[model samples]
Target chain A: MGGGKRRRKLNAERSGRIAALPSAAPAEEPQAVTVADAAPDAPKPVPRSPYEGLPARAFWRSGVTEQHPLRVADLYRKKFALSPSHQIATAGSCFAQHIARRLKGAGYSIVDREPAPLGFDAADAQLYGYGLYSARYGNIYTARQLLQLAREAFREFEPAVPVWRKGERFFDALRPSVEPEGLASAEEVTAHRAAHLKHVRGMLKQADVIIFTFGLTETWEHRASGTVYPTAPGTIAGRYDPAVFAFRNLTHSEVLADFLAFRKRVREVNPTVKFLLTVSPVPLTATASGEHVLPATIYSKSVLRGVAGELYHRFDDVDYFPSYEMVAGHPSRGFFYEPNMRAVANAGVDVVMRAFFEAHGIEAAPRAAAEPRPKGDREGGGRRKGGGKRSKDDVVCEEMLLEAFAK
Target chain B: MRLCFIGNSHIVMVKSAWDEFAKSHADLEGEFFAASGSKMNGLELRGRSLVSDNPSVVDQLKATSGGRTSIDVDRYDGFVLVGLNLGLVNVLRVGQDHRTVATVGKAPFGHLCSDGAFDLAVKRQFDAASSRRIAEMIRSVDQKVPIAAVPTPHASRGITGRSNQFWADAELLSARAEQPWREQLEDFIRACGVAFVEQREETLDGRYFTERRFSVGSVRLRGMTERVEEEFRHMNADYGALVLQDVMPHFGSAA
Candidate 1:
């Protein structure tokens, strides 16, 4: 008990000494405390030094300073302007789909990388959307899986059995099809698959800029084969072998290596292809990690962020976009994602796109007030007349006007 | 404070509200868990596998608490669990359908009926039951945390044609209606021991629907450009603002 008491006293004394170190120098030099305090209640007989005013300025500076600025809008505009001439390839998370969609809508040349038949009826397309690519129909969850897919596709390894009918053909199956009135013939399906693969390779060879969204570092893999399935095999259609299947939490180094390999492969296909990478801001709805859900989100996001940082530092062509930071790390609570999980706020997208444009000196087109909504009508209402209401538009506009006037 | 959430989209709205409200008040910190298309019976952990195939959520929880075993139950001041009709009704459907049909191995689960539509309905119910079971399991793991169950939303305007049937019979089935779901979800949550914040009826102030154009992802989901100036309009007047106001006062304050 005496020893414990002594230890506590020592700790208190040490803490006091640590705290007194900064003040001691000022005390000896007769520093101004009132100005130093800077509080509204502090004495105001004398004006603070110019350097003293810097704390508030420094605080504001800290808030806005960026380690790197990869303008997303500039990239979008450059990609869009070059779209007519260059075939743009997009792969990665759902956000990648957005880039592709925007490019396609703007009448640019976009390679069809998705396996599903595009351009089907809205209802039928929604159903097919659930089954495209792999089960979960989404891209591989980890960078390792993405690299593996690119490698496998490049190698053209024949499977034990063809996953689909070899000679099937489907209209626009290789591209986004708007109509889904009927099922494609077996021959059409096969033809479309082959055409799709060829198109993907061609796009990789010709792409001026490849936009990839690295989603999560957590993945489930086949232990024996190292095959990374998009979803757990059973969740979609593939067979799950417990003996060969294991979950992996990809490390920063592993993710960096995969990106390096992935970049090399892209260059091998098209040496001029620049890579733009972004982390998806969407949080996982659930996790199998048997831990509290919130912490799992942080763990996955942090690892991905680390990987992005490492890759950005190592390669000059590789740039990072702040989509994840813009939404998930926005000054305000993110109001982008829909309640039903179907759509993200268009306004949020607009903000990031605007930032991208401003940095690149590209004139941004006015966002359509009646921007289309997603399936399930998650946004509640349809559209607004005149202009839709946004909580921050006025503040943003005011700030912009002030900056312009100051300039 | 320890808080739990129930229902689907309605619960999500509440979460969004709380998220925004909490940002302004530094004194309060809280967490919310909401499952889309989830039901009450799905919360149960016993007699079934509750382990999610998606490891993100569990991994998040583990990381937040430092480790799996170190989940600080005492730090939570309250718990809220939202329960809607979908979970309960679906659990009942699973039992009823399991005995009535013998589709052999044709159906993956024994509870599904032979007809396609009926089978889809059954599948929907089972999904809800599973969600409830999961919720219950979460509660079981942390008994000290309070739980709240919310009901599904009711049909309002905007839903037309065959889709209207889903919302008409709220007691029988929890349709995809946002309003009814919010109301029932709030009631159930209160019953489950957490303080309730109601929003459905209050959310619909004075807005009405009209045709308009709207986009999703890169695809245009609704493009009625010729007929209407706006793609869609609020069916209620004040829109969802009232619910936000009602819940704002309770935020960061004691239950």
Candidate 2:
């Protein structure tokens, strides 16, 4: 008999004797039987290793190489269930807009504390940073940026410089792109930021789930106050001075600590709120770090991924969604990127959302009706055209402006 | 001088007032085209004629214009588009819920909006108005034909405690919110290259409410012969006569 058959016979005999033991009895200690204990008729007992009964997922040959990428079953098991009633607030990098749109489209209750003004169409509304997130804080690229926003929202901290200027227009230093044209005066920027913070407070207080996508580890921050910005100062409006601004490539511990601090701050107002974390799969547009952009992106993403993993393991309420792996990982075979290999194709977003909805058992709702154009004007205005696919201009990313400076 | 008055339901008062004026003044001729609500949205410039395909609107146009199915642009010296969903009252309603840095502390309950954003929204509202579309259509047909656009008249008095509570909130707002928008409307109309006929100041209670005497027995646009007492939106012939007098001079006609 082969070793396999002999092992099957031994397994069956062992189970039969174990089942026959009394329910209250202690487990018997293994006796050191020599060759005398072996049955006379049985072939030498096969030596069975612990890996004998492991599932197919435990082995790379069966787990990955043999399975289709889309059919990678049990890839995600949701740590917590989300119902339609949950008031989900989403904010992160530009990629998180896809998650927000998908969730809102799925009939989940998305909190829009800073909703676009009534009668404003979708395109102009998005340009003004209204519908992109719950409170229009705009692309929060780093954990430190998020923590800073929360602190500012709660009035616990104030940045050294709250406003930045370009020509005659002034911008909020924290979320500079929110007002593309900028405000007329520094006072206007301050007032807008104040009002925005009030709504941010309301959003944090009301949300049951806060879905934040960890986008980058590299950031530009004020040297003195440690106030991190979503983009480098000069990328949008403010002047970039090396004396005042410093480039930071955040380490694993720093990113993890920033998130924990942010989590704690939010919990002060909302004790029971759950966190859903994701890492944006998009690579860096340009890296200020002397390292080549390729390795810089990998380092940034790896650090963010490591932090997510640590948080996922550390807390019961914190859940990590592998959107980064879904899009950037080799399983998709580079099929999910645009020709430039930077922007995520819509197909990739669809795949990630499909997996997300499947795991949560949420059926897709009918797609939203196309936005109506501004009355009497068939053209012009910031409205989207050409079917419903988001064009390249659909997402507003300040980081992409960094490439303009590259030689 | 020959002029054409075009608009939605609110044009009825202007037409009624013009008929009374034309009975005494023989030198001026006024042609009127009226469609109720958004029916006028279908009216477009096809070649040099302003026309529509909707049968009811066509019938109404024929009835109002002495059997003419469409207005020939070359025939009219000027055009006055009245009550085509353009108004400043909407600014007041929006202000009740949102305030700019200029008015933030004053309206404590309202959400704060940047002054620039609020200004853009106000401008966009005017840009999307149906009255602007009509002006554009007429301009495309005949750029030199002087075009004057009139906003919807203020809500009538005694609308305060009734079903029209929204007007009351607007009425309570001060001139701080009202003056800037009125200026914006003028600038917007001038930028469109159309003349703006300001609603008669004496006829208004504040900026948003017409005197009860002028609106007491306003007539419906469809059945122009009888007056409807419950109507607080349409003005009477007396109120219209005053506005028409202000509108005719823009056409270089004094009637």
Candidate 3:
């Protein structure tokens, strides 16, 4: 709380100083009547370039070009440190699952309102989308989706079609993957969603820190109700009808406004909650926009990254974690990606988490013991040399189905 | 009807009780195939026989089943799988950190989980039990023979004075919460094509603890000697007789 207020004051002072400076460049002609003419006896200020005295991290040559990707230090600095006791709630794209998993493994007080019950297979629980977030709302790819979820959870708004029927089973349109097999009937879906929302509401009201990873800008929404779905209707469940469901690529202002609204709604019940935002580094599986996939991904990521930067500068409580830059920035030279060049490698996640933990002054929990390796592969342990087979693409990305339609 | 009782150490009670039942009913015949705790897990379906490669399990099979190291399962009219860790205690352990709608008011410290999720979790736990695995193995070899699973009995009521942290943690459980776990277990076993023979209702003190008389003087599997008074999980011959009574009806004319 104090951090945001302090940063705002510093920013105001900096702006005032900038405003007091000379607005235009001086003429090349020799000025006989200089500062010396007005104050002949006064001391003259020394000439210096605007970039003088800036830290090494400010320059590309020293910050990235000359340094090893893994050794590029000071990539992240916490605006406010997280206490061991803080109740941290996490939600976002599939990439955010890495953050939630790491936070949980590191012994942070990660708030899990709707945890998978005991004795369930850990892998099956993950498949069912439990323990993947603070609540089992599946992926919150767009800010609009996040805002819609908060509204729905708090009973302020209801989606036009809450249940999507696929064959004989019904799925909660908001989070189709959370119940992978779907429910027996629409009534069952409604009951599950009601139970889920109660926990989501509690998670939002009580959390001290909420970390969100902005994933995608392209979303499918109900034309009438403006309800943004996590994935396209037909991707997970429900038939994709052009008239009923409209595809929209969100602009910068819309993403910012959606997050702002989400923050405001949560703060209404929890005034002290802080937000940690990041941009998911994994590229979009397929873009609905007419542009090429590469350019579309850049546009989506750029919008999210810009929003995070603006939010960081505007609010002290809204810190930005550069997981995006750590994994996908030029310094890494695409080294952290798998062979497919989309899913992040295990090593990439390690580098991001190392920086995150170091910034918070916390020691990261050691990784779980690796299984016994084959004779020739014992050297690298977890991640092999280069982005080899060990870069497990384990995340559940429903958007990947769009790629199946490519051919 | 000739019956084959397959299980771990918990089968001792049922085996001794079956001997008593056979005296009055000359038409009924039964044989027990047992091993130490979890050694029954080593029993594999080899062709038409259920056999074990582990020498200790092989020795146990011989000692318990009248020198027969392998069972020709088709010879038996029905099979009862006894205690391979499917029971109320394991279900109660899950309540340490999660409560369903049935348990929310009773459990003050756990997260409130949905009843459906909690039931699925309980079903998975029961499904994972070695008893269910053995039942499935039997059914795979013989699809038509009647098969039933008898879960381990509830702890003795004498546990009230104990300082075991596990039992203390289970204090959050009530009969209402336990009902779902029971129903889930039965449903899961039935789904696996095995009948679930529940613990005798009269033998239970509460829903999850057996009456002390049924648990007292329980015998060990290695010998027919009585277990020490501190034993809380093993059931005595009287308790086993009730279990047999529950299992018989599932085999139709066997009752």
Candidate 4:
């Protein structure tokens, strides 16, 4: 009789606890929910809106207001907080440089494992793609490029087509613009890439955060070997051969698959690393999809943004920063871009950085007045005195080569 | 002590500074043998003297050494090669990409190592080539003569003006090179069996660039007044005296 009475008491307690909780649990909540027991008849269970009490990003977001102008409010609600010592390693498409520069300026520790030689000036250093990323990998504009780089850096995954030759000069097929003038021989390029991989490995092992800005879905690659390149062949160094190389417009599924594979590989090496993802706000400089460049840019960014968003939901450590929506999205209009309507202006960078800091609870950073143009602007134009034809003051975008084919 | 100076347009400052330096050290006398362009590289060792290879080249050595066609290399107590391409950009070009501030995330440098091994190798190779040429010529004339190499000076910020917008990436390097680039250059020149005159530590701003007050004038440049109005790399007599000061200790010592 006493054992039966105790079972009855337990059932009563469970019902009381369920009755105390608010109508429903969050549909998309990750982790466990807390429950408490109360004395009596509580409110009946009812379905609650998933959007209720959701973060600002779950709703319509706008940073641009009549008063704030270029600035945005509630743009980034960070899932993680970065301290001054966070080892941030940045590498991605041409636009990614702006993010890296701002973080470094704000005094957050950027993981620069491979520093250039002493006495080099800013212009010459960048010409050789020195300060752009963790290991000098030039404008990694595609998901395939990012996945291959991670694989090449850590695993034994070597591209079957290792080197590309233009005239007598040899270039690393993966990242043709990195050497600027190109290497003397295939052996030199391999040796150089080996050393670069070491730095990349170091970056992977140590970085607390790796912000990858996906730039393009359009890619040209080795059809047989399934190798992807930073830029199309011939624009910078290699010759374009249809028989050997094939143009691929990656769909949403392909990008998502690659990112998942990248994340899995990354976990094998760097288990604790948190990933911050952003789709490049800059438009495509050229399109091989036989479509207008405008629609091509849209299609590319959309696929990338979609994959990145899904990845955010799929992985706990992966967070989406929405730099794409902040700059290219309709809320801010197109005020952040330069006259070229492609290059993101400093004010756009200013607001992006502001949101990043605000969301992460990092104090506002002081103005970096000594900066010339946006770091992304260096992706195209100009020349280095001692090096190749690269923008000495601005960014050097390989996509700018498309402008050459115009008219 | 008598000195013979060998240089390009950079020789003008040392020539101009001799008197002011002489006020403190009256024992020094110097002579110049220089011309513009590739002609400066044509200095040849004829017996124990240097002579002009080009007939069109001006031969100031002829006047300095009585009526001889060339000045006796052994006659001079010291030799200085001023204003060759000592510009930091020259060192920067030898595979040292010092820009650290940039966007996005890190990527692999194509056929290039970001570990600095590739860049350091390039720098070493360039230094070797330059050292080989200088060592061969200097040892040919006389191993005993104290020779110094002063590279191109960096452009002054005063002339360039303070900029806020363009140089966020330069923080990758110290105002001066953290690695002893001067010492490395000195070691290279010394391995060449010659002395290297180091730039003064105090005269530099953070970027390893020279100050504007020393930015006097260059004979090589077309439009230079007595006062330097821009961020010119060449130095004047006052600056020349500073270089000479670094040169003094080596000269009095046996070569």
The best candidate by DockQ is 2
Q: What lDDT would each prediction earn against the true structure?
A: 0.44, 0.76, 0.76, 0.66
Which model scores highest in TM-score? 2
Q: Write the per-residue lDDT of candidate 2 for residues A1-407, one digit (tens) a residue.
A: 99999899779868775554445333233223357758898786543434444566665556667777765665677999999999999888755677778888898999988877655667657667787788978778889989988898899999877899999999998888777778889988888888899999899999999999888888888999898887788867899999999999999999999999999999988999999999988888778899998999899989999999999999999998888888889977878877767677667777788878889998854434542211100001122322132333444356446654553
Model 1 - which docking category?
incorrect
Tens-digit lDDT track of model 1 for A1-407: 69999899779868775445543322222233454567777556553332332332133233334222322222232222343566666666555555455555555566554433211222222333322222112344567766765665576442221231212322221111111221245343343345344545665676787777776666667676565644443332234457867777778788888888888987987887877777776565445577765677778878888888777777777777767777677452556656633235666666666665554444555553433322111011121222223222111111122122235
Instruction: List pairs with backbone clashes in candidate 3.
Output: A4-A316
Question: Which pairs in model 2 have colliding backbones?
Answer: none
How does model 1 score by TM-score? 0.42
Candidate 1 residue spans exceeding 4 A from truth: A1-86, A103-109, A113-140, A156-193, A340-343, A365-407, B1-255
Model 1 error, position B128 (Å): 39
Each prediction's DockQ against the real complex: 0.01, 0.40, 0.27, 0.09
In candidate 3, what are the lDDT values of residues A1-407, reduced to their tens digit?
Answer: 59999899779868775444443322222223345445766776443434443566766666677678896876688998898799999888755677777777788989888777777755556655677789888778889999999998899999988889889888999988666667777876887788889999999998999999998899999999898887688866799999999999999999999999999999999999999999989887777898988999999999999999999999988999999999888778899988878877778888888889888888986654531111110001122222123212344456445654455
Q: Lowest-scoring 10 consecutive residues by lDDT in candidate 1 chain A?
A: A375-384
Steric clashes per prediction? 109, 0, 1, 39
The 10 consecutive residues of candidate 3 chain B with the worst lDDT sum are B101-110
lDDT of 4 by residue, A303-362 (tens): 999999999988889999978888888767798888888887777887887878888877
What TM-score do all the candidates reach, one by one?
A: 0.42, 0.76, 0.68, 0.59
* Model 2 C-alpha lDDT per residue in residues B51-153, reported as the tens digit of each score: 8898998998888787988978889888888888777754555555666666544234446776656665666665666788888787776668888888788
